[model samples]
Target chain A: MPKLSYLKALHRALRDEMDRDESVFVLGEDMNFALTNTTSGFLDRFGADRVLEMPLSEQGFTNFATGAALAGRRPVVEFQIPFLLLLVFEQITNQANKFLLMSGGQRSVPVTYLMPAGGHRPGWGAQHSDQPYSLFAHMGVKTVLPATPTDAYGLLTTAIRDDDPVVVIGPLACLGVREDVDHADLVPVPLGKGRIHRAGTDVTLVATGHLVHEAIAVADDLAGDISVEVFDPRTVYPFDWDLLAESVGRTGRLVVADDTNRFSGLGAEVLATAAEELPLRVPPKRVSRPDGAVVGAAPELDAVLQPTREQIADAVRSVLKESGWGA
Target chain B: MSVLDEVPATEADSAVPDSAALYRTIRFIRRFEERAVELVKAGEIRSGIHPCIGQEAVAAGAVATLDADDVVLSSHRGHGHLLAKGCDPARLMAELAGRATGIDRGRGGSFHPSDFSANVFNATGTVGHGAAIAAGIGWAAATAGSPRVVLSFFGDGAVSQGALLEGFNLAALWRLPVVYVCENNGYATTLPAGAAIAGTVVGRGEAFGIPSSSVDGQDAETVYAAVREAVVRARSGGGPSLLEMRTYRYHGHHTFELKTRLRYREQSEVDSWLGRDPLLIQAARVAEDERARVDAEVEARLDEVVRFAVASPYPDPATATDHLHADGLRPRPGSAR
Candidate 1:
């Protein structure tokens, strides 16, 4: 067994995939020095041509990756900041995402948009802090937010292999987490699947990205009082509804913990869908950042803006406390 | 299909008098825009088109030099490029009408029409993004030992975009078989090229060491001569060439501008360019009887095209996710139960 840090898992996946398929190569800014740490040792392992360092042109490089993909090469683009994704949104959503459909099934853009440090990083200020995986999912781009080291490795490998444009949001909180695993067990996981971290009967807590670990801790803390089922959706856009339905069917209640803004966030979609179709005994609840939240530089302000573990526990308990069934 | 067999060190002159082909291309483009404008006025097309009214010669001349296997990537104002690439007018019209018989099966409307079978990829609404896609196609073609060239068309406004310049760097560095044709049509929507652009459009490509030049885009004959040379250079392993076709738009940037009442280009300037119209320039070269025959043939073809487009059906809503992926997998419906 080897200790695999979340970042290491990402490095392993990139190295393995590039080794397995010669078409796999990386392009990004400051990638020569491994700025985001995901591309650490990449330049050394794969020469400069395979590990390309680009200029400060987000829109340009994003489309360049699209072109490279069209050239029969699989490109993995690394974005240092989350907001850079916002700058090149049109390139991804309009150009890369629309090619296959617009070409009437004549072309495919197999490009991966990897955001290494996604979500709020305290003291990084307003412009830097954002968790926008939900935006990609909403635009119908393949979005994956893995919860653990193994899932991160598996999902990233799968994203690079996918025929369409895919976005992988690696949350900041999950970067430090580590797990013991067999190196041989490292494999590509299928997209659009969910794994139940912990199964219980009282309430089904749907958590994503870094919040999945928080949810597992909360479930353990209240293990004696309430039965909590913690579910992590590895892929958000083409979400595994069958697995979610099965989890909620046993619990009869739902709670979602997300790191995105409250308005039209993934959390809202989750709770809305669950309430409408699932036979929940009580009203579903979601804990997320305040509407249009901008994570500030101050530690206290950032903490207050983010969804907390206590908030998740309270939301779960509240959903459990509700007495009435569907009106 | 592989038309350019040898690379010429200097610009190549057309062996055949290319006025007829150039005129037919420009005429098809002009008529296509006119019909699309009618559809836009009727509200049948939701996204108002960025009509390439006066900038037809650039597309006609550049695309005329390309082979059937060559790729053409275009910008938002791309009806001219489509027509020059020999895209069927009826299917293009149907795409504007949101009918399933369209090249994109009605998925792409005005800003994003694509026909990959003809090697005409989508003309992205995003400015300057098509350069990279075209470069990619060129790189792929060259790697596979195919002498296939890619012609990417953009406006003078795209020169300011960093992405377009980045594409220049990549194409020049790799010696990719690509030709970047910048149609300097004076205005990008309301802003004049002088106001939006800082330096010369040809200078941007020259900065990247790509063989760059400026040509009279208004004259179909001149444009055809310049593009033929570039195509010969690309096919002969000479790498990329950039041509800045100095032209002007006769109409507003988009048809919607006709409603907004903006004074961007003067009536006199537009009239001066229209006087040297590619349609008349090439038509004058042909005999009077041949010109009449070409006109009658064009009119009959357009009528049939309109009939086909109007009769085509709208795509079914159930297959909304079709062609999103090359693997042909539709995304699972948003989970409710």
Candidate 2:
């Protein structure tokens, strides 16, 4: 067994894919120096041709990756900050994503947009902190946010091999998380599959990215009184709605903890889907950042804006109490 | 049948830049556009097109320099580019009519039609974004050890876009084999270039250290000579080059201007540009008998193109989600169940 940190898993996935496929290359700013740590040591191994260091031109390089994909090369574009995704939204969604349909399936843009540190990090103020995976999911782009090291390795490997545009977000908080793993067991994870961390019958707690760890910890703390089910959807766009419905059907309650803004967030969509389609004994609840949340530079302000384990536990208890099944 | 497969071996391998061929190409595009406008009036082609009536030489002459294997990224006014690149007229017309037999299967209408079979990768409606994509394609070709040079065509309006400039920087920095062609038709939709652009079109290229020059876009030979030199440079690994083709459009930006009178340019200005029509300019170089014969041939070809486009069938509504994903993954049915 080997201990694999989340960041190390992403680095390994990229390095292995490049080794496996010559067409797979990395293009981004500061990739030569590996400023984000995921692309570290790639420049020396792949050389300047395969590991390209682009200028500070987000939109240009984004569309450039699309062009490369059109020419039968798979490109993985790494962005340093999460909001950089917002800068090239039109390039990805409008141009790259629509090429397959616009060309009448004549072309497939196999470009992966990887955000190394996706969510809020203390001291990195408003401009850099944003979790925009929901935006990509809404635009029908395959969006993945991995919660664990093994899942990160699997999803990123799958994203690089996919024939369409995919956005892989490595939440800032999950980068340091590590787990013991058998190296031989590492494999590609299929998209749209939800992983159940812990099974219970009283309530279903749906979490994404970093929040999955929080949900699991809260479930352990409340084991004496309540029975909680923790579900982590690795990919958000082609969401595992079937698995979600099945879980909620058994638990009879739903609560979502997401890091995205409260308005039009993934949590909102999850709660809405559960209420409209799934059979639930009580109303579903969501714990998310306030509407139009701008994380400040201070640690306390950032902490207050982020969804905490206490918030998840509180939401879970409220749902249980509403269903009149509280211990 | 694929249009590229039907192309003559010699025609696909090399473009001789002869007078008759250039004249026929210009005339074919000019009449094709006129007939397309007529189709628009008849309510067959849904939207009005950006007619490249006077700017045919830029498309005909520039495309004449490239081999069939080379790629082209075109702009909104791209019918001439497609036709000159050897795209079948019937399929192009079908696409404009939104028929199932279109080059893009009617998925992309007038603004965005792509025919990968012809090596015309795509014609984006977005003004300037294609340049970056073109650079990427060039970079990919270089990496693959292919001797393919990508030509990116855009309006003078695209010179000011930050993305296009960034593309220039990347292409020059990496020495990617791409030719950036700017057709300065003096106006972008309605705004004049003088008002929109800051320094100059060629200056934008020079600032990026890319070898650039301005050429008379009205004359087919001049445009051919300039673009041919750029293409040669790119193929020889000399890096990217920019050519500013000073041209004009005889008609309004779109066919809707036929009914709505948005007075931006003087009628005299229009008359002056119409006088420099690429079709007539090339028509003068050929004998009267040859010109008349070419005119008759173009007319007959366009007649067939129109008939074929109108006779094609529209796609079924049940299959509207087709081609949305490469893996044929359709969206969930209307109901949640």
Task: Pick the TM-score winner.
Answer: 2
TM-score of chain B of each: 0.92, 0.95
Model 2 lDDT vs. the true structure?
A: 0.90
**Which candidate has the top score in DockQ?**
2
Check candidate 2 and list the clashing pairs: none
DockQ of each: 0.51, 0.79
TM-score of each model, paired residue for residue:
0.89, 0.97
Q: Once model 1 is optimally superposed onto the true structure by TM-score, how far is the C-alpha of residue A49 displaced, in angstroms? A: 3.5
lDDT by residue for model 2 over B1-337, one digit each (tens)?
3222333456424535667777888888888999999999999999778889999999988988888789999999999899988888899999999999999888877888888978999887778999999999999999888999999999999998999998898899989999999999999989999999988899999998999999999999788888888998899899999999999998899999999978999999989988888888888889999889878877877888999999999978887888877777666666776
User: lDDT of model 1 at residue A92?
Assistant: 92
Query: For residues A201-306, could you state the per-residue lDDT of candidate 1 as single tens digits?
Result: 9999999999999999999999999999999998997888889999999999999998899999999989878877788889889999998998778888888899
lDDT of each: 0.84, 0.90
Off by over 4 Å in 2: A324-327, B1-16, B333-337
| TM-score of candidate 2 on Cα atoms, chains taken together | 0.97
